[model samples]
Target: MILSLIVAHTRNFTIGRDGGMPWHLPADLAHFKKTTMGSPVLMGRKTYESIGRPLPGRLNIVITGSPKPSDNATLRYVKTAEEAVKAAEEAGAKELFVIGGGSIYRQFIDRADRLYITLIDADIEGDTTFPEYDVRDYGIIASEHFSANEKNAYDMDFITYEKIKK
Candidate 1:
């Protein structure tokens, strides 16, 4: 399966603070939903807890040390990132999106086949950040710029990168 990561970060690569985002961008949320609509999204436990519910249109595989009682059909708990990938594969996923909260991103970034990044233009203060990675290993396949508006909190650029195959 294609392993992809979808994230929104600032210039300093800050992704979260106080267990939530520093800003709210409806357009970004819409973009996220559209991009991952039919794909299974894998996330760390904190990421799942922050959202507090399963995303309606796709399988939500959460990686954690402890399992929770789950009655939600779309939600599944896995002990490790490897198990998360296996769950997605077992569910017949062609693509698995590693949506995050710091540590989770660090674990699978080296294996990522693709990245969907939204660069928010602003000074964001956060405790969580995206791990540093060499951009030269991936080529930008797509990019879109959106100016600040009523729906979007800040000027942002949506960039899609695919790993440069050897």
Candidate 2:
């Protein structure tokens, strides 16, 4: 199975503040929905709660030490990152997206096969951050630049990086 990490972060790598994203970027949200629509998304319990509900059109796999009951058909629970991956694969996911809160990203960064990153051009304050990794390990496959619009607060670049074949 192919595993991918999809995230949007500021130049400082800030991902969240006070359990939610600090900026408003409708285009980024749309890109996220389009990219992970039919796939399985693996996220930490905190990330899941931040969303407050199951995301429609995708399998929502939440990793937590304490399992929570969910009547939502789209929701599932796992205790570890490996379990999350195995569950997604067993569910016939060819590609799994690791959508985050910092610790989850840190846990899967080394194992990710692809990265879909939106590089925001503004510095924002945040208590949560994206994990730092060596860019040398991946090669850029595609990138598109977007200017700030009414809905998107900052100029950003949507970049796709594939793991470099050794």
Q: What lDDT does each candidate get?
A: 0.93, 0.92
> Model 1 residue 19 lDDT?
98
**Runs in model 2 lying further than 4 Å from the true structure:** none
> What is the C-alpha local distance difference test score of candidate 2?
0.92
What are the TM-scores, per candidate, against the unseen true structure? 0.96, 0.96
lDDT of 2 by residue, 1-166 (tens): 8899999999999999999999889999998999999999999999998899889999999999997777877899989887898889888999999999899999999889999999999899999999887789999999999999888879999999999978
Which pairs of residues have clashing backbones in candidate 1? Answer: none
Error of 1 at 72 (Å): 2.1
TM-score, prediction 2 = 0.96
**Candidate 1's error at 11, in angstroms?**
0.7
